[model samples]
Target chain A: MSESNTIPKSLQEAIGTESKKLSNDIEKGAIRRFAEAIEDNNPLYVDENYAKSLGYRNVIAPPTFLRSVQTDPLPDHIKSPYSAVVDGGSVWEYFSPVCAGDIITTITTFENVFDRDGRLGNMIFLIKTTRYTNQLSELVATQTTTSITYEPKKEN
Target chain B: MNQNLYFEDIKEGMEIPTIKKNPTTQQLVKYAGASGDFYQIHYDMDYAKNNGLPGVILHGALKNAFLGQVITDWIGNSGKLKMLEVQYKGMDLPGTPVYAKGIVTDIIDENNINCDLWLETDKGDKTTVGKAIIQLPKK
Candidate 1:
């Protein structure tokens, strides 16, 4: 990889090895809270009876709720300036519904690290890819979060 | 949803129904608590101003959620959101009227529909731009 002045050498060096895995249990409360937070009133997310009436195993989670199951892509104790990070955006793909009572396991990997010279200034960007699998070992979803790390402004 | 949208019912360029949301600081706080993203910039005005921002800005994730609702609401419960992609191009303020708008861009397959989506402020500011692939039942 080419030398990057903006991205942390530690971050760049940690790229494939920085993967982290975690599991979260899907519950009606969290799913309902997330749906309520977004102000989404979809019965598919909150009403178990309604969900089952619609042929679902149980009340299912909204698609973007998968982000809550993610842990930091970089392993804990890795020294890096994550405080400077800004939310870039995200991309998500859903293979199946995540229902209540599902134990969702996530394996997140640092997909890439690089620098982008933009109008603001040279900045570092990191991409983290996470795959979500259920207790049934079914791949439920995959998501990638892009974060940009802007250098802290210099004080005069 | 009382009605289901079918692949055979929509055209390549037809616009899906839009969803408008007005998010307040209270809502942002709720979102922060729910999503476990407790960044002060989303709620604490002082922290936001100290960071060179005009005011507490809407979380990019919240905008994504709005866009998701726009698509999911239009596609109905039978539809599957196969893919959702978004870019945080700009910022929006809290307690403002922002609309979730989208247009069907393509019929990728007999069952898959591609659409372009965005978040627009009442002042016509486009804060986020995105795309989605929805799998609809065939008619």
Candidate 2:
């Protein structure tokens, strides 16, 4: 698709009306391995006894552990029909901890999209918002991520 | 914990200890389960290649979490992680060792000890350049 044809200028232009939901089973061992990957030995993520002492029901996932969860990409919207898409950047807000044995469901929706003219070239910003709820339906956290879409330079 | 590194203790040129993280496919799978992200690009190399990626790339959240861990571990439990922002510049492939390193670029004490952090990755080939701001313990 051509640059002018696909690029969006505002939140209404870039955000899709449809949203997708995803579910996952967060396990204790998985949480431990995640902690190990980052080399964080915090007992809250490992020792059950220590966690209980701290009033947690079970081992809690790292604050940013939501990264491990997969998200459904936004559906098509008006404007951009670009052939390619790549993650431009992301912003995160760490709200609460996720625990093992908790089933997490995340709903993702397009938050915003904008066009920017940079030194390298023109780029498209795609923002997605995600909400997490546990099996109990308690709100766990919310993350809004922005991905940049780069299109091929227009040809004469 | 050393609270001696007040806003005054840090300098723009000073460096924080770089953390070397060796992530395994098994760990990636675990991360995938917890994050609820089942994108085939993270697990299937063939699928990833078809989708224009070099290999199964590690989740962006995983990379960002590790960056936070690096700074939080250094600051300890007494400190509060105020804010962390990162731009996904490149890929962090599975089974690759990503070294998360940061340097203190700026320091300010606006009610809290705040320092600007810069994060980078080395996976044989370079991938992901990130910067973060963290509040550290005050003396």
Candidate 3:
């Protein structure tokens, strides 16, 4: 297996380029579906009355619910040459809750690109950081994600 | 349905309550639909097996959501979850019980508490490891 650095110069040049996307107003039905998918019956994510009792304007979303909202286009430069890509990990920071009816927006930046040796062989990793804001332009949350791209070894 | 935990009520080294989750293939399918992540690895067992996975695996984001629940449920209504960071080290399969556990690692102040959290399989293999910071109401 070859171990040369696999990240293309074009892709490397994309680091720090930011892209933005805005989402539709968060919906209660969508939040409920997400809560059900995760099998969390938390009233904060499902029952509006329960959330109101907790002082929330409406049913709020789970911390990771933003995953369902950000529908955006990925810049072509971020795509890897390898056929397989695996999620390396993620770090998330939350400042405010995302309530139903709040339209969310995100600004994503290509943060880093690097290569490393792994059990399989040489791997290239890419990191992206995204900032999420609500309709009031309040910072809601931020997530940093790392992904690894590699070619599968050929079996004899 | 648990009682709210105030900052004064919890101490360092104390274990927060655990939330047990059993992710079924059906749930993964629903999660795929709700999340708009139509990646075949989460639903197509054969495709996943061909891709080096033993079988259909749970989505990493879904596991993160479970950890979020662990913190939010423990903090109750008054307290707020400030941050959650997780690293996916191992793959988890559907039909297995994954337990989300946490131990209070540091008391930053009267209002902030830090915890070391992880998700482990019934066999005790840690599938995810991370840290979380929660803001608890001062009593």
lDDT of 3 by residue, B19-118 (tens): 9998999999999999988999999989998888899999999999999999988988888888888889899999999999999999989556889999
lDDT value, residue A33 of candidate 2: 75
**Best candidate (score: DockQ):** 3
Candidate 2 chain B: worst 10 consecutive residues by lDDT?
A: B110-119
Query: Which regions in candidate 3 have their CA more than 4 angstroms from the true location?
Result: A1-5
Give the Cα-based TM-score of candidate 1 against the true structure: 0.93
Model 2 clashing-pair count: 8
| TM-score of each candidate structure, all chains considered together | 0.93, 0.70, 0.94
Compared with the true structure, what per-residue lDDT tens digits does model 2 show for residues A40-87? 777778988876775677888776777777666566453344455666
lDDT of 1 by residue, A1-156 (tens): 566676667777777764656888888899999999999999999989999998888999987898677564467633335457777899999998999999998888777887777764677777888889999999999988888876676779
Q: Which lDDT tens digits does candidate 3 get at residues A18-103? A: 88675667999999999999999888888899899888889999999988876465687677787778888788888888999888
What are the root-mean-square deviations of the candidates from the true structure over C-alphas? 2.1, 5.1, 2.2
Instruction: For all candidates in order, state the fraction of native interface contacts they contain.
Output: 0.72, 0.57, 0.83
What stretches of model 1 exceed 4 Å from their correct place? Answer: A1-10, A70-73, A76-83
Worst 10 residues of 1 chain A by lDDT: A73-82
* Candidate 2 segments exceeding 4 Å error: A1-5, A8-30, A36-39, A52-58, A68-80, A95-109, A117-122, A131-142, A150-156, B1-13, B94-96, B110-126, B137-139
